[model samples]
Each structure stands twice: as C-alpha cells, then as structure tokens.
Target: MEIRDAVPSDWPQIWPFLRDIVRAGETYTWARDETEESARAIWMAEALPNRTLVAVDGDTVLGTAKMGPNHRGPAAHIANASFMVAPQHSGKGVGRALGEYVLDQARADGFRAMQFNAVVETNTQAVKLWQSLGFEIVATLPEGFNHATKGYVGLHIMFRPL
Candidate 1:
C-alpha cells in the first residue's frame, strides 16, 4: 500500500466512503445529511498551508486524511487532522499508516504539536490508537456529542507534541 497527495479525480472513489461515514454519524462532526458538494469542498486538496492524502493499494483507495494548522496565525504551530478509512478496510491498519504519515509530515513542516479538538469518546478505537501514538486526552467535554446510537457522549480533546 502507498500514501500520497490526493487529486480531485480521486474524490469519485472517496465520496462513497466519505458519504457513508459522515451519514452514519458515528465519528465526525459533519451533518448527517451533508451534501456531496459541501463535503467535497471541505475535503478537496489545497495548494499550501494544508494537504490531503489518499492511501491506495494499486488503484483502490483505502482511506484518506487531511492535515493543517489547528488554528491560524499565532496558534498555527499546532497541527490538526482528520481521517476516514473505507468501511470495508477498517482494522487493516489504514488509520495507523495515515496517522503516522500526518505526524511525520507535520513535524517536517515545523508544526510544534498536533491536536484533535473533538474526538468522540464513544469512538474507542480512535481513542486507543491516538493514545498508542503518544496523544493524551487533555480535556473531555461532558455529553458533547450526540451519538446516533449512544444518544449523548463526551468529546475528547486529544493532543501530542511533535
């Protein structure tokens, strides 16, 4: 498998999973009925100050990630990121590979740290993976997320120094 910068053309493959993930309302904060155009606009690759990557085995997209500053100007040293693995490809280490790549790239780009501002607490796999990667949950907003199945749950703000 290989990971590289995503091209607009790649969205044709990415949309299926991206739509499914967001609509499921299991992780990301995107609206459950988010339109394709709106989601694409947010996920599309940018020229600089941010980037998006896709993981593929040959021509099949396995997952994707986007990374950039957690905040602008004075707080730009802290990078922020989000990832989405194809549902069929989950548990195959796709997320780990993406996470590692983001960390390495952020450090190389001079980011002082990484922060995930709203990680859903009920997403235990993500919580565990970030922890194993040296991230700490610095804060948890009580009943911060409205999980579809779990009703309400905490949102964890995870951090790790680059």
Candidate 2:
C-alpha cells in the first residue's frame, strides 16, 4: 500500500466510503446528511500547509485523512486531523499508517502539536488509537454529542505534541 497526497481524481473512490461513514454518525461530527459538495469542499486540501491524503493498494483507496491547523492566527501552530478507513479495510493497519504519516507531515509543516477537538468518547477504537499515538485526553465535554444510536455521549478533546 502507498500513502500519498490525494488528487481530484481520487474523490470518486473516496466519496462512497466517506459518505457512508459520515451518514453512520458513529465517529465524525459532520452532519449525517452532509452533502457531497460540502464534504468535498472540506475534505480536499485547498492551500499551503493543509493536506488530504489517501492510502491505496493499487487503484483501491483503503482510507483517507485530512490534516491542517487546529485554529487560525495565534493558534495555527497546532495541527488538527481526521481519519476514516473503509469498513472492509479496518484492522488492516490503514488508520495507523495514516495517523503516523499525518504526525510526520504536521511536524514537517512546522506544527508544534496536534489537537482533536471532538472525538466521540464511545468510539473506543479511535480513543485507543489516538492514545497509542501519544495523544492525551485534555478534556471531555460531558454529553456533548447526540449520537445516532447511542444518544448523548461525551466528546473528548485529545492533544499531542508534534
């Protein structure tokens, strides 16, 4: 498998999985009914420093990630990122590879740290993954998310130095 910057031609492969994941409302904070245009606008890298990446085995896109500043101006030194692996590809190390690459990329971009502002607490896999990657739960907003099936759940703010 190869991990590299994503291009427009990759979107057709990415959208199907991305749409399914978002509509599941299991991990991401995006609207369950997120439109294709809106999702594309957010997932595709637009300018310097920000990036969208893909993990592919030949022509098959196994997963994707987006990384950039967690905030603007004074807080821009901190990076933020999101990841999604196709359900069929989960457990094959795609997410971990993406995480590691994003960390390296963020450091290369001069980021001091990385922060995840709203990690759904019930997503134990992600919680553990981030923790294993040296991130710590800085705070948890009690009952911050209204999960589709689990109802109210905490949203954890995770952080780690680049």
Candidate 3:
C-alpha cells in the first residue's frame, strides 16, 4: 500500500467509508448523525497544512488519517491524530501503514509527542495497533463512550513521546 496526502477531490470516495465508521459508533467520537456536509468540512479542514492523509492501493483508498496540533499555543508542540480503514480492508495492514505514516509526519513536523484523545477501549484492534506502535494508555475516562451494544465503554487517552 502507498500513503499520500489527501486532496479535496478524494472526498466523494472517502465519504462512504467515513460515514459507515461513524455510524457504527464503535471507534471514532464523531456524532453518528453527522451530516455529509459537516463531515466533509471537518475532513477538508484537516487536509490543509498539518492534518490529513490517505492510504491507497493503486487507485483505491484503503484507509485515511488526520493529524494536527493537540492543542493551540502553549500545547502546540504535541500532535494528535485519528485513523480509519475501510472495513473491507481491515487486517491488510492499511491501518498500520497509515498510523506509522502519520506518526512520522508529526515527528518530521517537529511535534514533541503524540496523543490520541478518545480511543474507545472496546476497539481492541485499534488499541492493540496503537500500543504496538509505542503508545501507552495515559488515562481512561470512565464511561466515556456510549457503545451501541456494550453500553458505556471507557475511552482511552493514549500517548507516546516523539
């Protein structure tokens, strides 16, 4: 798989997978009822400057990620990121490639560390991937995410020093 910067024209293909993932309400913290326009705006905004990427295999997008300053001004040196892989492409290493790419990009951009703000504890696959990449569970917010099937699940605050 190849990793590359995402352009606005890529949104049409990305929307479906993004929508499915959000609607699943299992990993990401986005509102499940988020409209297409809002999602488009968020994704596009991230693509500007320091915030987004897509993993592609030939012409097909296998996954996508967004990275940015974890906070503004005083906290700007720390980076934060999110990742999503098309369900059809899970287990194919798309997530891992995207994760590694974003981390590299963040470090190259001069970030001092990386943090993931709301990783759902039940999303073990993602938790494992991040942990294997050197992140640690810095904290867990009790009943942080309301899982569709599991009721309330803890949300993990993961961190790794760059």
Candidate 4:
C-alpha cells in the first residue's frame, strides 16, 4: 500500500467511511451528526502544522490519519494524531502502518514527543497497538468516556517520547 499526503480530491472517497465511523459513536469523540463542512475543517484542515494522509492500494482508500500539535503555542512541541481505517479494511495492518507513519512524521516535523489525549478504555486493539509501538499509558481518567454500549469507561492518556 502507498501512504501519501491527502489532497482535496481524496475527501469524496474519505467521506463515506468517515461519516459512518463518526455516526457509529463507538470510538471517536466527535458529535454524531457532525456536518461535512466541519469534518473538512478538522480533517482536511488548511492551517499551519496540521496534516492529513491517506493509505491507499491502487484506486482505493484504505484509511487515513491526521496529525499536528496536541495544543497551541509553547505546548506545540508535543504532537497528537488520530486515525481511521475502513471497517472492511480493519485487519489488514492499516492501523499499524498508519501509526508508524504518524510517529515518524511527528518526529520529522520536530515534535519532542507524541501524546494521545483520549483513547477509550474498551478499545483494546488500539490500546495494545499503541503499547506495542512504544507508548505507555501515562494516565487514565476514570469514567472519562461515555461509551455507547458499555456506558461510562476510562479514557487513557497515552504518551511516548519521540
């Protein structure tokens, strides 16, 4: 699969899965009915230090990732990122590949470290993947996430020095 910077033309291909995932309310913190314009404003943001990337196999878009400063100003040295993989492409190593790419890009872009703000406690696959990639769960906020199925769940703050 080829990993590359996402261009405007790619959003049409990205929207379907992006809409589905956000609507599901299982993994992300976005509003369930988040609008297309808002998604573009965040996902395809045209601002400094923000970037979006796609993982593709030929003409198909398997997944995407967005990365940038975890916060503004002096706190900007710490990087943050989020990922989404098409449900149909979940087990194809798409997430692992994307995670590795984001970490490298964060370091290349001069981030001192990478931090994940809120990783749902029940998302074991993601928690495991991040751990395997050298991140540690630095803290867990009890009942921080209001999960759709499991009710309240912990939200893990993961981190790793670049």
User: Please, what are the lDDT tens digits per residue for candidate 2 over residues 125-144?
Assistant: 99999999999999999999
Q: Which is the better candidate, 1 or 3, if ranked by TM-score?
A: 1
Give each model's whole-structure lDDT. Answer: 0.95, 0.95, 0.90, 0.93
Candidate number achieving the greatest lDDT relative to the actual structure: 2
Worst 10-residue lDDT window, candidate 3: 43-52
For residues 1-162, could you state the per-residue lDDT of candidate 3 as single tens digits? 889888887787789999999999888789999899999878754533467788998889888988888898999999999888889999999999999998888889999999999999999999999999999999999999999889999999999999
**Stretches of model 1 off by over 4 angstroms after superposition:** none
Better candidate number, 2 or 3, judged by TM-score: 2
The lDDT of model 4 is 0.93
Q: What residue pairs are clashing in model 4?
A: none
Q: Which residue pairs come into collision in candidate 1? A: none
Q: How would you encode candidate 1's per-residue C-alpha lDDT over 40-132 as one tens digit per residue? A: 989976776799999999999999999989899999999999999999999999999999999999999999999999999999999999999
